[model samples]
Target: MTVPTPQAPRHVRAVAVQPHWSARDFTTPDAFRRWMRAQLEMARPHLRPGGVNLVVLTELNGLPLVLRGGGWALRLRTFERVALALFLARLPRALPVLLRERVSPIRALQLADIDANTELYLRTCRELARESGVYLCCGSAPMPRYARQGTVLRRAPGVLTNQTVLLDPQGNLIGVTDKVHLTPDEEAGGVDLTPGDLNELRVFPTPAGDLGVAISLDAFRADVIGSLAAQGCTVLLQPDANGAPWTSQEGLPPDPARVRDQPVAWLESSWQVTAQRQIPYAVNPMVVGNLLDLTFDGQSAITGPAEQAPSLRSYVLTDPRPGFLALAPWVTEGTPDELRQAGLDRAAHSGHPLENEYREDTLHADLTLPPATRPAPPRTPHEDALDALLRGEARAPRPGTWRAALPALPLLALPLLALALLRRRP
Candidate 1:
């Protein structure tokens, strides 16, 4: 048998997709097929670059399978339990039968979920890689099951983990990386998820430079972006799900604006962060809801350190950057100091109380507020009222008193005035 040569290094282009919600709502296999077909249609154009890889994200249990002529490939099956199910129920029993019948490798078999049989699935994937001549990457949630065994609670601390594996052309395991940052809630729950050490950033070590893959949506964080850039990560693969839009204009919902400053602060600090959404709905949609949106909403772009910024090279099909290139954009033409001064000037012109007046002759410096001195205690309402009374000003009666005494007080006043008038006449 002629040995297969390694695939040539090609430009990597990735698109992040959030499959329509209808795909997950249905239980029937036919509905699933139709949805999968539609998704493939949406994704096909983006996959044209020769070395392009698609990062498809979905929930732990919601992976989709793509059928070839003779066999099938499981797409984005991240959950090991799902892998186990496929192996026991389908592959192990069917493969031998297909070989005996002399069926084409692509046409004679079907792909299904195999939960609890990770090793078998890995072996099968390696075999497919050797035969099919296409690289396959399955993105999944980094659940705690892979870290240790037995009865893991989803809510329990130390249950969430992030990991990804790459299969070579001959189906050999190339590299794997555990995710660095855990979701805040996951951290609060005491999940053992911590940032991956710099040494572990090796998921994409092909001839194409380090192609570090970020499972779920960890690529959105500023620290993660900076860490990946620092480690020379050229491409970042992000698998994400469709989520509710971050901003709600109607008063009916919580406003993303209230917490927008936190991410803005993060982006301002770290410049290189590129993310592509992947398939499988498991962690994608839920994580998107938790963190702010990863897609740039065209509102504002971040300007920061050039070395740490995303590649200034635009995404062109013809001139793509090598292996997992940084997604953050650098401000090569503009300096950060200039940007800072411009921001300060904008703030001053926008009526900021602390901003110094602009002077034509000289640069204006930021004005500092004087240290506040404590004022004497304020007088009580009662004390103020007594003081007013002592000063000969008429004290305002309590609210109800005017109504209660109106008739009696007016009658007495009129009679007393009449007596005074008669005395004066005499």
Candidate 2:
């Protein structure tokens, strides 16, 4: 017995967005809903005519707003930090409230609040899809939902894996893909995410064609990308939560070539996945806005098939600003079967473009990736501060200043005081 070959739509119009989202956006659920609505409105004219509009978003992006909606515990835990002593002191009080967040009447009530807001946004997306007459991937934002005993999986004690939701042209759910690879850095920040079942990696049928969703760092793995290609995923939906500065080289005299290569435009032009014999088209959206001193770089991008990667005209590096980058919108062509087959063939050999480990994997595994040898960019002040927080250390600033002398005063006097005490005793 043989399976039928899957097909791709003749045309696809994918849109990647990197809008302004901040700590302020997490103030209220309604505020966030409205912001998403506004973004859809902004992308209105750019959407393809009767084609797939691939929309991506940051991973677990709506979480802060949801947590804040819970009133005190999460809000205090997230935004307002007390001293180490004070934080530990409140654990008795904070602990119960946190546990309660996942249980009982409180869970139901909060879900009602969050779910209602989410539904409102989905309704808006559906209406927009109906009105605009285009397929919408609708950015993937996670909800800390409660699932009752059901067909999906055995009943759990609330809290499930992060799921990426997509809205069809008529405002209906086309697919729900749970994120497979959760970022370790995110887990360190107190959000304990569960990985999805590997079976969920299968492509979902869409009006545009076979759609596969990979969240954030999942795309960093060559094995993961290979798996999707093997499963006949014609188009890739990569929603990212990258906070790395696109233009981190702030102080040092910069290289013109490096600056030119750092934009969404550069990725769109160079990252033709079809040339690598993977998917014919891909849309990747990045999260923007600063939260708790962490400033996100907005470099959302789009890519398609090319004969070969084009060497572009190099321009002088001035202040290269980052914002919503767009490629000349066009329709996607070609069936994904050949593209996917070619990818599988390359993975079988080690001909993958990324030089990434070309192999199949389970939903979870330790992937050995090559070390990054890219040029290091200078850290911004905010970046340096964030780096300190991550390292869990503090240092005295400006060694030559008087402020620095204050900490060293006791050390300087220690030997002198010891000698004086010894002489007096003699």
Best by TM-score: 2
The residue-by-residue lDDT of candidate 2 on 176-244, one tens digit each, is 666777765434233444566665466666556577777766665565677777777666777766553
Candidate 2 has what TM-score? 0.56
- Alpha carbon lDDT of each predicted model: 0.32, 0.46
Report RMSD for candidate 2: 19.7
Clashing pairs in 2: 126-171
Candidate 2, residue 393: Cα displacement in angstroms equals 52
TM-score for each of the candidates: 0.37, 0.56
The 10-residue segment with the lowest total lDDT in model 2: 360-369
Candidate 1: worst 10 consecutive residues by lDDT?
359-368
User: What's the true lDDT of residue 246 in model 2?
Assistant: 37
Task: Evaluate model 2: give its lDDT.
Answer: 0.46
